[model samples]
Target: MTTAETTGGTTAGVLAARQRSAELEELIRKDPGRFRVLTGDRPTGRLHLGHYFGTLHNRVRLQELGVETFLIIADYQVLTDRDVAERLDEYVEDLVLDYLAAGIDPERTTIFAHSAVPALNQLLLPFLSLVSVAELGRNPTVKDEIAQSRQSAVSGLMFTYPAHQAADILFCKANLVPVGQDQLPHLELTRTIARRFNDRYGNGAAPVFPEPDALLSAAPLLLGTDGAKMSKSRGNAVSLAATADETARLIRGAKTDPERHITYDPAARPEVSSLVLLAALCLGRDPRDVAADIGDKGAAALKATVTEAVNEHLAPIRDRRARYAQDLGYVRRILRDGNEIANEVAQATLDDVRAAMKTLY
Candidate 1:
């Protein structure tokens, strides 16, 4: 289904669904929770609104709710696309800056580079052995990614990305894995590994891995200017770091319907529909309502209005990002402290995992 349909459906179910999720999340929040959270970004490019709305924003919310948040810099995953491998350092730093700029509060969130955590990688071996080749191949995420890449020969790492993700979550003993609807399959695999390890070693004493549930986000998907998926690689994404002029230029260049008059009909007029959606998100109003307010205003006027709204929304974030960027020391200190906390928790989990598997030396 299109994002519009998904948004509409979510709006219908949101009241009850959000109540349940929030209640459960609050339970996890109040206690000195054993329920750890594992969520991250692949360091292929700087993050954009899609990243913000889809996950990062929720991560901030989760942190405030008191879940121990581990933000993984999936640096290794960058190798999935060959072109990105050469620029790994630049990309990793940009990812860090983006996270800091987006109000992640490194003080509250544990941020670490995937490659820096060796013990986590070590867990991959025993974790990998628990799942079969057939099981990995059956994962819908792997299948979709393969189809998207159009590659006949997939990397073992790419095919076993779920396992790596399992290692990421299991290494932190994460009880909650916040994911989009599309990511349920990978979370299922993580749960399987957790259960298997607990059954093998826990001897019914205590659960080693908490089977994580999907903390499905209720946020609307933000489309790119051209009405496709908002991805940095697609050249359609609006970066969090974009200057006012750049944002205005991009919004001005955004595709709109030929109707001249503004209306929000996603199916028939995706371009203008996308603009309306963006305006709503920025202004915190319903897209339909925003369109009605526009009345007979031309698309040009609508785009100009949206451009101003977007810039206004992003200006403070951009300014904050600029300050953090100037002081690399502050950024480093934040990540360093986060990494220390992450490693401490990860080490405990890995120790338990090793003892459970009898891999301890």
Candidate 2:
């Protein structure tokens, strides 16, 4: 696991994190104008609990707040690391279901796939010029991903996905990105690219791109049960679509320290800390506070608490997911409409980009 995964705690612990949250809240609350927001997930597989506590919950909240949000199903990005073309559609569709199940309203938030927006690929051409190879290599997120890849060497597409991500955000003129605290670096890189493009090509006129701010989540991303990251490959993830009994079974079988006292000391008690992290995120309390409350409690009680809280959080989502799954055609239509919206938004941005570069015929 990377340092980000190891440091399993909420953002409330830090002063700068609080300031950033305040700034983002001010933007979300006080700013009357429509704020363009962009965010998404890769179509690797079904999203898990880590996804909810980390990012998806924020997406739902922002859209409810009336932000003009665009949620991308980054289908093409799935090809970056793995050759899963045959199963791409399956993963993408399941990802959409998870998004909708998580309360992302199709009427309010435009949800589209990366492969559907052809023009989105064009933005990467010029965006690729704004950064250096060294900069891409230096991206902490990318480095972490590359380090974690099973493949011996990172592919070119994998290396340049950040540039593609910039295209994902800038193409829609997203001025704010909802991200975890660990993802602040990637957003900073996007800001740098936007700044570079405006400085070089805008010629002291209207800036073509917005310097997007990172709307950081107050909760830290939860790790897998085994103290590793919460990913499918690790087999440590609990899916959003998992049955209640299945969830309980997984939590029951999860690892814990032999000492059995539920403390939030991540360094000494990583496995137990991970459960505490999950419970704290679910209950909206500090991990230390949670640890103190459950002091000297055995692992059985801790596991039961995490399982119950997680199930409570997932109950509504499961209800919505079942209803949405009943009519597959309706879900497809929502994705199609979202595809059109994404295409239109992307084309307009492409036109503006061509005009700024004087490349339009």
lDDT of 1 by residue, 1-361 (tens): 2121222124533343344456666676677255678899887788888887778788877777777788999888776644337678777778888887878877678899888777888888888888899988888888878777734566777777889999988788776777766676677688787778777788767887787655667767677988788888888978998888988888888887778668888888887888888888888988999898887888878988888888998888898889888988777777677777767877887888777767789
TM-score of each: 0.89, 0.89
Model 2 residue runs over 4 Å out of place are: 1-18, 283-297
User: How many clashing pairs per prediction, in order?
Assistant: 0, 0
Best lDDT among the predictions, by candidate number: 2
Writing each residue's lDDT as its tens digit, candidate 2 over 1-361 gives 1212222123432345446657778868876255899999888778999887778888888877888899999888877776455577778788889999998999999999889999999999899899999988888778888887766777899868889998999999998777776676677677878888888889789999998866667756567877787886677989999999999999998888788677898888888888988888878888899888888778988898899988998999999999888988988899999999999999999998888888999
